[model samples]
Target: MRLLIPYINAMIKLRLETLRLSVSGRITGTVYINLSKVFFPEETWNDFPLTIFNWWSHSFLNGNEGDYRFMDGPFYFKIIKKNGLYFLEGFFDRKLIVSTELDIDEFQCSLIHNIEILLNTIKKNKWDIDANLDIELLNENLCKLKKNI
Candidate 1:
């Protein structure tokens, strides 16, 4: 039994390392909100920008992590990664509106695509340069448009 325990521990460690690698990135993505539920019922859904320069910087990413909260704007959300699956939870004034597992790769792709669209729109508007535009601020605004900052 003792010998089997060691093997089990090693396997668990390896699995954890792989899971960590899967999510190891800048952690940029937009969290969509059903504003109709939070605000006017006639309104549709909206996206909220979210970004973590280095998600690993958070203590939860270290080991046996707990829920990570998002406390910005009128709404709130939480992110949780368990056994390699990433879950996002959305709330409005402490009431849960949505909870679902997210595919990180897909989310990243969507984020990048939205960023490209933003860039193109800027170029189309001839606001790419000489407008004294703040790139960082533009990025933030672009994120708020549906991607992450």
Candidate 2:
């Protein structure tokens, strides 16, 4: 299956492209989503690897609404579920940037794919990346999420 989620009038196409790890263990990567060119960091951000996303995935699975701020900046993403549909919205300084709908299974796949990207990067590099990565917990959560998908 392709990574691109169908971008209809009100649908979101989001994905993460993991670049590399810094000497300090922060993830340097890009978030690929609709209108992401202007908002996300050019190459990567000096941010925790997969930590926010792991939490976001877990919350998305268990809750009806949740919000996440990006790179400690004004950019934020909020997810809300109603009538069996998921609404994904992005905001900057409380001003709405974009809003779109995501499919249930599509979002699950997005989480699984993102987790795999981070986990595989660590595995392939064979770096002592766990000091800040918390890999064991990520792997555990990944397994549980995979079973659901």
Candidate 3:
């Protein structure tokens, strides 16, 4: 999948810092966001049709900030928008984890790319997505964001 609008060369990337064994169709790995200012981040997980990434796609794609808290039990992050940029102030289990910022459009592109890569990873691993609601929503968001791009 590709973005409908050409990306504006943002200095942000989402890489699989580490990958582990698959369990129940979920690819467990570190969804590392390589950006300019994010520090002490701990964004890893099961690539199941879960809430984390889907919620992220929903929030940023619609130009809205998100507050995510689900993973390692208390994984949390809040995306704040300011001056045409987005800031993330987050924590894992009550300990501050992610604190960072990036351009708004770039942030949306990053989010769209995350879903695209995760979906690719899912397909590569031969995980089933016949009825996964999270995958469905993610795909919808991906397409929607791409079209407006």
Give each model a TM-score: 0.42, 0.72, 0.67
- Please give the lDDT score at residue 97 for candidate 1: 60
lDDT of 1 by residue, 1-149 (tens): 00101101000001111111113321122333222223211122222122221121132223313333333345544556779876555555666665655554443444345445444544564542432334354454445434231
Q: Judging by lDDT, tell me the better candidate of 1 and 2.
A: 2
**Per-residue CA lDDT of candidate 3, range 1-149, in tens?**
21121222233234554544354545455553444433223334433324567766676665567665444456556667778656666566666644555456666676777777777877686666444777778788889988876
What's every prediction's RMSD, in angstroms?
A: 15.7, 5.8, 7.6
Question: Which candidate gets the maximum TM-score versus the true structure?
Answer: 2
lDDT of each prediction vs. the true structure?
0.35, 0.59, 0.57
State the lDDT at 49 in candidate 1: 21
Give the C-alpha miss distance for residue 94 in model 1, angstroms: 3.1
lDDT of 2: 0.59
Better of 2 and 3 by lDDT: 2
Of 1 and 3, the candidate ahead on lDDT is: 3
The pairs that clash in candidate 3 are: 5-149
lDDT for each residue of candidate 2 in 32-94, tens digit (9 for 90 to 100): 334333323223344454666666666665662787555555666777777877767666677
Predictions ranked by TM-score, top down? Answer: 2, 3, 1
lDDT at 76, model 3? 58
